[model samples]
Target: MHPSAFLRLAALLALSLPAHAQEGMKQQPAASDRVKEVPSIEAVGLSGLKPGTILFTDHRDDPAKPENGLVPYLDWGRVRPAERAALAPYAGYAEPDYLQTLNGVSKRRHETLKVYVAQGRFVVPRPADSIDLASYATLGFVAKMDPVIKHKTLNPADVTPTKDPAAAFAKRPDRPWCDLGTVCIESRYDLEGKLPLGVKLANKLEDGASKKVAEFVSFQSELRTLPPAETAPLAGLTKIDAPVTGGLEQTIFWVNQILRFGKFLAVFQPMPGDPAKTVVTTYMALAIKADVLDRKQEYARVPVLKNLLPAQVLMGNSSFNTGTSISAGLPTYARNRMTAFADALAKN
Candidate 1:
């Protein structure tokens, strides 16, 4: 299948499924499971919401309490059989192996969440297309060096338009794995013994004749190293031996992704309280993908089971259902992340 087609399918999976549907598809948890289930909110369906009005809600999971965090939302069983068949020949689709390693990050989880809006108005520093949205230092994640991966855009001279799907897919010169029309980021903390966690942000905005709509979606997942005792699952299966080499520090894998377009957009409007300043109200969807395990020994043994497994599961009970406090900080953190973006836009 064409890479673009794959992306389209991913987007479709992200948008079409409801929150309950997403939760239902996960590997069923045991009766003793205590993972907290949080409600999902929709920014677009809020009452009195107009076409351009931005509504925000920070539905988040606490990182400090890794145990209570949400599990992954996507699984192969949820996918249509035809769709799975089409992707079966791809690198990660057929079975669990090293080929699933796209770039440096593992493509193990296919989780997604809906976009929610947060309160505030932001100024678009420059044209959306011109801004370096993925500059980590500029966004306050990393300093000096640009940690965000950069991909070469398809040179018009290199691409040949064709009616044939196979020819078109093969000739497409654009970075096939890059998120085509969205801004995406993946970040892991530098320090060791720090939960092996990562934050993934992927968002998109659509412009209508008179108004523009934007969706901000994020996924937080755990990236744990497999324990020596967990070799039972790897017994018959071919383990991709392509592990990163180097010292302990060198062996640490960092998250990376190609950022496409910026999802941040601002519109001027007068409202109660702050009428003069540009209050950046962004639609943010902060999702903690549910990571659950039924029996003690299930570790994604098959393609279907792999979808049910997430790295967080390896952390044991600590990474299960979250408490109220974990989600309590979501609204503030969501606002803070977007605030940094707005501030950067102001300086730009």
Candidate 2:
């Protein structure tokens, strides 16, 4: 039997064994099972203009545990099988081909959206009474729609009085629909030893006159916390002040700085002749705080308190190959930063 086939057989045998017996069997640990299970939130009717039992857009009226407040909604109406073929050439180490293909196609044509929710203890402290909660949530992904183009043909015979048959034949009308694509959504968060609760919703939005609406939605499973081991890595990084813009630019800047001064080859390596490849992947950390000002006091006179909502980080890999490729180191670097930031946040 082929070595790969033998390995597969061995894996099957090991997995088929009783739980106790399998534990006794010795083998190299499988790649840490960090791959998370995407949840299905839409099937239970969690997405709509109004918030419902499963849906969460109406947080003001329908509040859930802070730790279970987020949801990911995915719309795949615009995704076609052909587009997947166009992406095969670009799929690899840090470049999981399927994910890269999905990302490439998603960049051009809208397909999926991943939302996140918080599932841990959080507090919004106030002067009189503090609001303590178990979860928090937000829309982590938004994709803008692309425009469509249409083509029209004009006839030369209509302009001239000439009765030439050739002119009439050459003036055939032709019209083609301009293909503008849809939107994409992706969310990232740390599993720092705490089982994070999350759900994904997928559906189609109604088509509008100027732009197509999002539709064909589906969501992932229900909220669940991460096991202790998974949450451990997130306990390291320091949480700094939220940046002015919550976009990926700030994270990119920080990763670039670490690459330049930190000199950590295991985390980052500069690609010669390519400026874009030097950026390491960094997770976007987000915190939501709520404050109620006193009417009797002036705006500046009121005290402000901080509340750490469900922290979310947008995890994306940067290509060192001039946008052509990605490396494994990007995620490794991102995880390290998340750990450090989480640690710092806990301290503060």
Task: Give one digit per residue, the lDDT tens place, for model 1 in 200-243.
Answer: 11111111213211121221111112233332232112111221
Assess candidate 2 and give its lDDT. 0.19
RMSD of each: 21.8, 26.2
Writing each residue's lDDT as its tens digit, candidate 2 over 162-189 gives: 2333222112133111111111112122
Query: If scored against the real structure, what TM-score would every candidate get?
Result: 0.27, 0.18
Candidate 2 local Cα displacement, residue 15, angstroms:
6.0
Window of ten residues with lowest summed lDDT in model 2: 197-206
Worst 10 residues of 1 by lDDT: 245-254
For model 1, the stretches where C-alpha displacement exceeds 4 angstroms are 1-193, 196-275, 286-335, 342-348
lDDT of 1 at 301: 31
Best by TM-score: 1
